[model samples]
Target: MKSIGSKWMVVLFVAVGVFMLFNGRAQAAYPEKPITLMVPFEAGGGVDGFARALASRMEKDLGVPVVVSNEKGSGGRRGSIALFKSAPDGYTIGFPHIATLIYDDTLGETKSPVDYSKYAVILRVDTATFFMYVDKKQPFKSVKDMKSAGQALKFASTGIGTPSWLIPSAVGSAAGFRTSFVSGHKNLAEAALAVARGDVVGGTGSYTHFRGVIDDVRPLVYMSDKKSYHLPDVPTIADLGFGKLSTLGVPWVIVGPPGTPEDKLEKLRGVLRKIIQQDEFKKWGLENGYEPDIMPPDVFWKKMGELKEVYLGLKPQMQEKK
Candidate 1:
């Protein structure tokens, strides 16, 4: 009953409506599908355990399964690459420590696919607090005793470029002592075990990773300038005259691949904020030696940039060793 012109207008309006409807459906709230959390460590490790626990809690909040995928290799480089290569749809995220993210590239170990800028850092859950520990039954109790031995102490290392290696190397260099690393352990737990079995003189890593084996090791010194809240009686590396070499603890950040939608990022951030707030999470963190210190995206990324500069300064020294 309408004129040809009016009919065409009606058809155009309907077409636009249909297009918009489909577009709306396409852009529907993020995480319509299950999200994947890529943990760059073995199943039994602390990072893996934390990822699984967080995924379980996130699933409750998201109403969608938050699956944990262990893509362990290259001292976490493999998992980080997998995370970098994943589509930027907010479906895949990575839980790699700050050190691993920059280590490979900084040391020229390998070319990483991740564009550090493209990574949308979601949260910084905690900082890695390392302690220098020796076997409880070892003959030497103090650094002076080890120094007086007049030989290079055999230290258990996770691998080259990890905190396990860097911390000890830095301390030994600063303290004017000699150390030789025996690399091959998968994680700090294994390294600590090696120390216990007399395979190595000492081991260094996060206190959380060493908690299970603390009974078998004597913590010689904390790596931070200040004493750890958990190990109040322990002396800091600074107090022992190696303060100049001590780097701030490495940050543990959760990051999404490039081009992740801002809204989606915020949604996940909110969920994580709530997750960290849960009493159960807080209790577990304390038990595991993880300090609950969550930071927003801006602050987290800013700190990451600052830490990168610190690593850059250390690169010349690292290269000299190579």
Candidate 2:
């Protein structure tokens, strides 16, 4: 019996050694294959542009191709579902519409839109400076004009629950006017077109979206306390005494599927940190109206919680467009 026990101990030690050896090699050989980044919007839009810009540099550093996959629908619901269902390997990462994530997780009465458990946040990239742009042809030039007009205005929106809708709706309510949308356009450009072609009076979106149609639409107010350097001419929501609504902006975040290895998550965070710190990346974001902010997972999740509460408080007013 003593001889048998000694033989079993030797076999166990050998097995442990083999396991460690293979595990080390596996981790060292990470990213041997290409990575797919899922963008929950159509190609050639602001979100897609941001993803491509980062993916270009990520591909060079990671020594593998980084492909961007566009999965457009339902204000980022379709793509989010696909992303969460994807294997938790580090190769798959994506951007979920933050508003949709918050609404689906807490506010919505229906079943959860996506698997909350499978969502693992990597880091936050930046927040957009949202603006309400009025068409050049409209008599309304600023928030005051829209309010004083004392008439219902039609605007374009991505969807009902999205920032594209909620912010504008809330602003209108605050301004003492009823606002409705020719809503359901997929991206900023599409909604901006409705403004340019004079389909609707104007719509709200980030500076990048309106950049493509700058001449057709006039920026009225930025949804923040401070004016963007890129759009120095535009006033802030705070300038109109609505500073509390300023925190509402489209936050761009990067996320991997659930169960991403700790090593890979750390590596990704480090690599991405380096990328955000680059002067060129910063310049690109500035020019495009993205305030490039990088935060670790802990800080990112904390901010997410705070934002949920903010929106939750506004939910009642928004639902009724009060």
Best by TM-score: 2
Residue-pair clash count for candidate 1: 0
Error of 1 at 303 (Å): 2.4
> In model 2, which runs have C-alpha deviations exceeding 4 angstroms?
1-15, 105-111, 115-118
Candidate 1, residues 177-266, lDDT tens digits: the string is 777789878878888889888788899877777788888988888877888878888889889986654554667778888788887888
Instruction: After superposing candidate 1 on the true structure, give the runs of residues whose Cα lies further than 4 Å from its correct spot.
Output: 1-26, 109-113, 143-145, 241-248, 319-322
The most accurate candidate by lDDT is: 2
Whole-model lDDT for model 1 versus the true structure? 0.79
TM-score of each: 0.88, 0.91
For model 2, what is the alpha-carbon lDDT of residue 40? 91
User: Model 2: per-residue lDDT, tens digit, 82-148?
Assistant: 8888888899998878766776565554545566545788888877768998889998877878876
TM-score of 1: 0.88
By summed lDDT, which 10 consecutive residues of candidate 1 come out lowest? 242-251
